[model samples]
Target: MLQTLHRVTILGPRLSFGSRPFSVSSILRANRAVVYTQTGDPSQVLTTVTYDALPSPAPDTLNIRFLLAPINPADINVVQGVYPAKPSLTSLVEGHEVFVGGNEGLAEVVQVGTGVSGLTSGDWVVMTKAQAGTWASSRNVRPQDVLRLPRADGLTEVHGATMTVNPPTAYNMLNDFVTLEKDEWVMQNGANSAVGQAVIQIAASRGLKTLNLVRQRPDLDDLTRKLKALGATKVLTYDDLADRALTKTIVKDWTAGKGIRLGLNCVSGKDTTAMARLLGDDAYLVSYGAMSKEPLSLPTSLFIFKNLTTAGFWQSRWYKTHTREDKENLMRTLVDLVSQGKLKEPEHEILSIGAEESDEAAGQKIRDIITKMSAGQYGKKVLLRFEGAQ
Candidate 1:
């Protein structure tokens, strides 16, 4: 019974593909979507529009209509021709055609293959394929590429849509690194970020302490208080981190019985080097971002004395090559956490995509929204929505 929030929702029984007896007008028609026709200059090329009919039902297909999608940092990078993975370039819609624009969405099955019984048309599911078109009305997809989402029970579509990228990124980083003993310390920067917040909660929930490092903001006290509320052991600023004795403080704060086991680096400039020096011997360091846009320079002593292990994580590529069982488990746990009010993304605004925006207007719309998020002022998630679907 997942329901749309603050909008008129149309919910019905799953439709049959073959020998379907439903009347034409009674069925939901023409989904609105945002898409692009060319690469480079996304604002000038991509557009949003609506189609009057659904794709022909296939026996091995799961036809899904999206409820909500997110404009992630990576989505902007891909649109700006910077990401390594590219989305598909085909669109089956009639006049004023458009290709889908987002990498993730929360969708409901409107129709399933006769060969597919594990997931029915009315069930909510996530795309199992790495590049499934999610920024659209309804898409016909192969059955295996669809992950029959476990019982959402109490999770909202907002949580379902965004809970994937950041939470999983945080969880995998915490899991794949060196194992930690109770009361042991783990150091990381970007303490205010969504992923960083998740890291704090998950690590806290697992009996590990976090030495969180954040840049000084106008409201630094509030940020520090928030992180501490999320179970941060100590919050330090970049200026505080510049002190050579800070490493000694971390060592002293941890139970010497159980030393620091790992360091997670996301803000890779001076912050990374500072975090590196703070690690003890046999420490594992993992990075998943380049927010500082600087090379991760480290001193040779880190390798010689500390014996640190450093690695990088790219969620899309990692999940693409890994098992779905892990994904399902992580997603299920994440939803449970979100439902229990222990995890969340900052909700910014919901976008109602227009039905008649020109291609240029549509592209500009996405570009404007992406640029706004990149500015780093808004502490909320930007959600893209269909005007009709909601």
Candidate 2:
């Protein structure tokens, strides 16, 4: 009877059945989403899917409305079917079984079920794990699938949407890899990247200084000023990595007899080897990303003589191994830092999508953003806002 009622409501107008005055749930014509069933190029495979009504929360679930989502490189890889973890494709919603494309986002609880606790309507939340299918106007997720945020006050959509992934990744990498004393030094490539920026801010807040290295660009000075403003102790180009004179200068001025205890490498390839060479004795070098898509080349002597250690870090893997309490604790710490104005958010460009926009229009706009990112033309991080909150 319930299934028949659902079908009738989805197919046409609401109908009364017996004593219950039948009506559609919380669904509305404003609900729309972008999904892909068969992965390929996102532009070719992604489709704009809309629903006539939003379903009420299940007994163990919360009804969510997406507020903001980001365009991470990993998200693009997920759409291309190249990511390590894939979303489970099922016909759970509107008989359209497909994988939604976002891995991280900030959402609002529109409704809560009887079984849920510690969360209420109008509360802000974020995905606690990957593959939560956040690239939609609305979703029905279980309590364990999301972590409740402190509050929406004093938090921007960009910060709330982006804080979960990069900030925590940077925070954990700094804390989990090696123990560093206050004022100890750490070196990392991709200094201008989002994670890099977060690393700079978080390290500074902890009284640790970072030796940041980024790719050489025409606007190197401008980039250097920006990073320094974000609390980068020292910024250099990749070209400076191979220069003996530059290394000598860095050692003389920055190290001051103390060794860099931690090394962060994201570019991999020769970049990884370059950063590894700068670590102190018995230090750790954590590789979090391979943005260069190149092979890592490690010198044999560092492992034997310097006793240097190389490790890898992935936030998703960490989430799987840790408890929900552990994650929430870390998130609380990070959020406190942001609230205290000790950490700065990364630069972002907001793309607003009205709730009433046509699916083709929305899909094309997303495609254009992806195209820009693919060509490396996008300078700032791209953020998607469902309404005009940006």
Candidate 3:
């Protein structure tokens, strides 16, 4: 006869099931999470905590197991207490109350509670709310807090995990601010970024042209080739913009003398001012981020003579002001774009935490990655995957 088996928690005592088969519920009790007790430098304050399995979902809730979560720059800011939005502190662990560190992720429904409709076990979903504490093995969330994907072919975990922030930011910035006819041109800096790549593909889908600008790098030629392959009309580095007259002539020729009407700026300071100079009259200049940590300074003449209008956008604000139905519609639109190949997943590397690794080791790995990210060492996005013990 086969011997009875037992399961052990990640940080707690063993749970023995003598002569009885282990149930799915019993097997899913171990969880590991990245959390912090205080806001400071992420590398210094962030640590990993393993706790016993989460309690079963309460009414109108579902238990979710995260498949992957991206460490967005905003998430780092949130951890450092620099970002405006903050996550709530929770005493999920036995001895301490801490804040979890993830803004977006893709998860699978492990179980559903009574009164929960439309979502069942094995369904894939992403949080509708910001700071849902997604950097973990498992947790319980309300049905209203998540949006379910159609499980269509080609909708990978990365797409869902990242869809909420970058893709939507690009889509909205393009649609909300200005109206561009087919073949019309849009200019944006930081075009090699995740949102920038999304802007390229989304603009291509709509027959709009994008003049993409990125910082000069060793692989400038290769990077230019990749962006062009993704439907960017042109890719040039900041160095190319140094000669103002030459750059304007080139852009003028590229746009067939129509000139660009929309400029997207994520990297502020002198480069953005140069990019703004290429815009035509009545153009809209939208600022979504300031990666350079420099103030945006545009010529007063641009506003008076060119009718340049400057504005800022935050996805979190959009979510707060919009209805649930509106959010679902936006997500569905993006998902369809992904399914149809109009949009490509951002370039990324997965940082996986093995089940056998200790909590200290996992935390150290995450801190190291954060340090690299802070130092601008990681060019591609970094995603986290925490493997649970079997």
Off by over 4 Å in 3: 1-29
lDDT (0 to 1) per candidate: 0.70, 0.79, 0.86
lDDT (tens digit, per residue) of candidate 3 on 250-325 = 9899998996889999999999998899999999999999999999999999999998899999988998889988
lDDT of 1 by residue, 1-390 (tens): 221111111122111111224333322333656555545555444455445457556777767888788877777666666778788766455432334667877788887767776788678887766556677777778777767666645677777676667888888888877767677788888877878888898888788889888898799999888889888988888777677786566556564645566777788987788778777778888888879999998998888887877899878876787787877887788777766666655545787565444333544676677667767655767788765442
Misplaced by over 4 Å in model 2 are 1-29, 388-390
Ranking by TM-score: 3, 2, 1
Q: In terms of TM-score, how similar is model 2 to the real structure?
A: 0.90
- Each model's RMSD to truth, in Å? 7.9, 6.2, 5.1
Clashes of each: 1, 2, 1
Best by lDDT: 3
Sliding window of 10 residues with minimal summed lDDT for model 2:
8-17
Ten-residue segment with the worst summed lDDT in candidate 3? 9-18
TM-score, model 3 to reference: 0.91
Clashing pairs in 3: 29-53
Clashes of 2: 2
